[model samples]
Target chain A: MDKTTGIRKRAWLLMFVVVALVTATCGNGADDTTTTAAAAATTTTAAAAATTTTAAAAATTAAESMTVAKVAVLVPEEPTDFGWNQQGVEGAVAAADAAGIESEVAGGLGYDAPTATLRQLAETSDLMFAHASGFATAAKEVAVETGVPVVVWGSPDDREPGLAAFVSTSAQEGGYLAGILAARTTQTGQLGIVISADDFNWTRHSGGFIEGACSIDPTIDIELVQIGEGGYADVEGGARVTAILIAGGADVILGNGDGSSFGMIRAVETEDPPAGADKVWFIDVIGDKTSIDTENILLSSILWDFQPTYLQAIRDVEAGTFGDVNYDLNLATNGIALLRTENISDELWAEIQTARDGIVDGSISVPAADTRAAAEQLLGCGA
Target chain B: MFDETLITAVLVGAIAASVPLMLAGIGELISERAGVLNIGLEGMMLMGAYGGFWVAIETESIWLGFIGGAAAGALASLVMVFLCVRWGLDQIVVGIGVLLGAEGLTSLLDAATFADTRPRIGITARLDIPGLSDIPVAGRVVFGEPYMVYVTLLAVAVAGWVLWKTPWGLAIRATGERPEAVDAAGVNVVVVRSLAVLSAGVFGGLGGAYLSLVSAGNFIPMMTGGRGFMAIVLAMLARGRPLLLAAGALLFGFATAGTTALQLVGVEVRPEIVNSLPFAVVLAALVLLGRNEFLPSALALPYVRGER
Candidate 1:
């Protein structure tokens, strides 16, 4: 080989090696921060082990010393989703504000194992809320390793004495209300349920919606379409899928997705209604999107307010009983409520309010369907 | 159980879905023909989607959004050209880096810019052909698409003709096949490949903007949703033929919309099976049509003058 060619090859090799080393160095620096936090947590655990004479005394000491100066939440999507992520962030912030403490949010983390992020947030925060069911396992591991308390969703069995807590929402109750509203509002006698995934919250909500619609009209058609297994942000998929349901004669759409709901709303706004209906209506879940409802097609939303439950978690932490009990959000607890919109008439609103009262007063029960099969059964799809 | 409206909707949805894939596949076909295997096409599409949506929201013009998206994609392709084509970096590694970088940057930008008030633009205008648009079922499916679809088809035809008919096309193919021979023949190999990659970026960017502007009418994080990778597969399967790429893209689109139609018709199959229908269709198509398909000899290889 020529000398110049050999030198050029060697220079390229050296450049690659240098770049690799720089990347490794940066990666190790971040690792060191996590390692230091883990080590500190181990030291604190050992110190706690050495000092306590009894469990009662230890609990007392923890209650007195554990200061919740700041709380943090981790969500899988951007906090502006106006759904699960936004509600989680706003709830944590509200809880912190209620306690006169600071709140830190680490959002758009995706559905990956955020172990490093958990440790980083744990370093500066007193309590961490992993705001997604997908995050439960990793959050629990990080909570145990870092000696920081974590709150996970839909994992009641993961709750420990002080390390991890579990919280859940009965979004189905609100979905039942939405179903009632949809049943009342639909002119085509058909409703659509579009879920982005086979999510626990979505299935339960769908089940409740089916039951509610059936309660008002036994033969009301409810067509449920799942966009994909993990189509949480698939806006186009959401739009086309909703279009299919609309073409099948569904005029009211009970749309459940993080960002894909916007697509459903868009379809409802843009598409022509089915044969008998004059307009298509959209029913959203989690957060309210009335501000962005420029088309005025949003009938209502099954609103979820996490503030009460998050505040209770904070109170539990302060009382040294953080993970001792699991939290459940229900209509009775005021954790979930149906949003009132101008599209609903006074008489229909009165009927929805009565249904809500019945649910809270133990006269009505929203069926819990946590799986696709169970939800389909509730809709009589099996029949 | 499929009624007229349902049939029309499925057909319309299928065609709408195919447009982005066809545009991206055609672009990737051009790049592959020039011997630059762009594994970073997904990133370019994503950046285009973001850039396009941002421009559309700001200027309130969908056409300007498409242009902005193409420019953003071209801007992204410069990285691939500089690092892989010129500097001879590992194409796969650089492409993967581009994908990761685009995903993170777009997500961050969307959160930072539109977190408070998520904005959505109106759908683009459709050019319904006066005569064809009045026909039963076929009219809406063929003639009722946005004007961009026609432009994309025209672009595909032009690209195919240029790749086969023009001297510039010969230079691009020669660069991919025999860079040394091209260099000996007084053609700048790097320039040819760079131009090909830039064209790919524009195409991919246009596809992404179509998703955000024409299809969804909104920008969401990771909104391209693996369509970029799907385009890569279509391009590869098409074997450098633009027309075949269009067919493969339409096949995928039809399968996607057909799955929804089946579910809506109360076809009580497992969702896993239903969702896999599109991919199964592609796999079947690949098996049937992808016989003796050959890629460029120097594809993904960095060409340095006077070096093996």
Candidate 2:
């Protein structure tokens, strides 16, 4: 209320943030580390104004930090579409529940300035999960100002000890498995990769897919096309590109997009198969659309489940090592996986499992491709 | 690679993609010519998409869906009419509000109804032109297209005729150039602008309906994906020429399909640059042609009846 009181509150807040950072960065996920940080946060909150100096000194100790009781996740869309936004929101909620904390979903925030929402969520939330890659900049700033540990995406370099952590999808492994499935399933020996955007994640998938497909038969024709620079939601564009891919004699299609995946599926549905093929098959990336696959063309999906990854982030905070790790969703970690449906026969599933095991065991090295050129090099496209 | 079948398919795909932009662009050109710069075309299209999808699903009639979509978009334009046209508010701000409002409302309605079903519409049956439909390649693509494609072309032609060959066209142009002069001429400037904006909304809505019912087969959130903005750019670059607007929209569509063609044939190029080729090439052509100079002088300015 008064100037001195306001100054004391500010000093107390600073002490808590510094203490949390120091404790988190120094300790491990041991019993003592959790107790020390939790106790420090509890003690500082109890008498922040009266003992600001003591609290500041206490916070510097390796074991002293704040207890995160609640976590909040922000997304640009509602979690009902069973896709990226839905998966992110649901994963955050699941992670919070696993971490024994309260979860707040700030969904449907739109692709705009999220500084206001991040700030508001930071006030009450201990760790803010900025789900969308678009929220990375604003979330990092909010974390610094509010002392909240924020999880952002796109750049692993953005991770700061006790402040912000980056999470990215390791789609290469799943892409490899998808490639294997396509190679084994396709009667025509032609595979398609329809990318909805100029995304590095998809490039990685393309690389792995091409490698896996070529590994089966070196001369297998692989057609790949991109919708546009930012065609994440370009459903019509996805459909049209997919049709072109089909026309190029691709019977097995691997589609990577958010909403555009549905269009790819639709294109596959409308298109009659080429010679030596019975029906067109589509392999989707990220989130399963098995429920909406009325045409029965969906073979599988490269699923990215962020719950375990998010839970590990909470565990890092508990051990005072939140921002020390670049969280990844990979096949080895079961973060990235291939979806199975009735379309995948039992024998194919067993074969796919063997490949998955190989990837996890490090026996099969699925090289990462972060660009179309790199992917073409790996897949031998145009070579 | 450029075989007749592939070329036909590519051309057909380009037409499907360009139809929506053509409708939205020609409508935007009329509105800008009448002095109202609408940034809410995206919202109008989005709302129209939902309206059309819902009606089509309910009635199992694609035509009804188109009409419903246009009506919904025109209805949504009432906000612009009352705010910018009547009360003379900031056109850009009101346009943004309308966009946001449409997004929220459509998303909410969709979640409530279609979230579970995720209903998809198949391509509507083509309106086969008697003998024209039998021709090779071009026949199936041009004459075998659904009725909406013909209506879109007719709408553009009609818009051009009204804008260039009618007294109303003179009044609309005069309103954009010198609204005070149009008022002195005893023609209500507000009424002209209102009609222009309303027509734009109608065109945008119909385009959205086609996008959902025929192009995509379903409505997804933000399905328009800045196409309304692209239409705005096309309209500005067309220099008030409807045919040029159609050409610009088709050029963009072909450029998009070209990326697919290049990649499918195993062309080893930067896919990122390839993906952006449509906008980059279209905008470059517009700049080379010096068409942006034709932008309406009084665009985005809210005119009070008596004030300068």
Best by DockQ: 1
Which number leads on lDDT?
1
In candidate 2, what are the lDDT values of residues A50-167, reduced to their tens digit? 2433433443333127577888999886666667887888788999998889999997787688999987786677788898878898887556544578899758778777777898
The deviation in Å at residue A46 for candidate 1 is: 10
For each candidate, the alpha-carbon lDDT, in order, equals: 0.83, 0.80
Residue runs of model 1 more than 4 Å from their true location after superposition: A1-67, A381-383, B128-136, B181-187, B265-293
Tell me how far the alpha carbon of residue A3 in candidate 1 is from the true structure, in angstroms, after superposition. 24
Q: List model 1 lDDT by residue over B84-193, tens digit each.
A: 98998989999999889888888888877776898878756777678886566667667776799899989888988998899998898788888999999999999999
Worst 10 residues of 1 chain B by lDDT: B268-277
